[model samples]
Target: MHRLKKSPKNARKTPHPKADIEAIGEGRRLAHLLRAKRKEITKAEQVRRILDTAHNAHEISLAENVIRSTMHPADQFEAFARLHHEEGMAAEDIAARFGVTAAVVKQHLKLGAISPKLMQAYRDEELTLEEPTAFAITDDHARQEQV
Candidate 1:
């Protein structure tokens, strides 16, 4: 059995396996724990978690991507929300696309405004969304009319 080392200060904590410690994979195996977490999870849970995490990550990533290019973050979220809409994503899902809570996305979605430029930036960066396409498009047509 291998003993596991404690995680760093900022890392999210994982369940410490009392028994698996000795058998855990030893390489600098945690390049990015999220990647490894993907490997360890079973299929049913994988989809849900990947989507959630992806959404959160995408939101932060989207913010940074716009700033680096000297673009407006508000405009960036709007554009992304639109493209995601094109791809059949829903308001809650679109909110997740940027890793924010549904309420947060709703605030952005209410505006008739969307940023074509930021959508382009999102595509250029190949950003990943946390919510799946299925959820993204849920009630989409209705929302489009409202928007």
Candidate 2:
């Protein structure tokens, strides 16, 4: 039977080897995800390299895992509204940029046009998303707010 060799019991390990391994794993995972989604090998490689070269790679990985969140629906509506009204971007253009359907963009536009008071209510969790979406069918801010 073959015997496996083991390191000396007192051998010193590399500094923060666990952290380094975690950072490398996170970078590889992100690179794989980006490549799979965008089909951009160069961009994926750049992202991986950037993560690998960070002074506190493990901290960055931890922050990304712990702090990052999906954009809130209300925030998305407001952003889409701003792009359409303030930036003069059409629903189709916004849809293309966001990888959503034009119909979904239109829905967001409608929700964005809702009364500011109601939007605030939505943000505060006083109203459900469906309620605001229903109100979006009308352009009358006063009527929407009154209801």
Candidate 3:
């Protein structure tokens, strides 16, 4: 490849000895530089694209609100009450996995919207509620100790 001869027109195009020398480090010289710069884009352009995507998501979330939040503050407590208060999952068992309080679980039970039968089941040991596969509590201090 080093021995390959260039046409007179090629010499007329780029008449620089340094360009030829730099072809080894800079990849085939002047023509490549022009091509690479033309191909490159900017980070600002990528971020603009991501923000456009979020704009569409925000619109949908505004419509669904509570349902959109999945397990919100009160929802987390309610789910726990069903599992522990009704299903007989002990306070410790609920706390170990959910990382919350026995009292908080009880509070959610009182506040939740589940069926009376289900609530009674958790309390009576007649039925066991399965903990949600995954959930989050929007309540920050519920799990936090006060004293």
Q: Predictions ranked by TM-score, top down? A: 2, 3, 1
My TM-score estimates for the predictions, one after another, are 0.27, 0.57, 0.27
- Candidate 2 versus the native: TM-score? 0.57
Worst 10 residues of 1 by lDDT: 127-136
lDDT of 1: 0.43
Error of 1 at 10 (Å): 32
Model 2 lDDT per residue over 26-86, tens place? 6566557878678666543533243356367676767656754445677788788888998
Cand. 3 Cα-lDDT: 0.45
What is the lDDT, from 0 to 100, of the residue 114 in candidate 2?
A: 95
Pairs that collide, model 2: none
State the lDDT of candidate 3 residue by residue for 1-147, as single tens digits: 589788742213223345333222222344455555787543223311123343455554454443332323333555666676467887778777777777766656544544433434444544444421111222322321120
TM-score, model 1 to reference: 0.27
Error of 2 at 71 (Å): 1.7
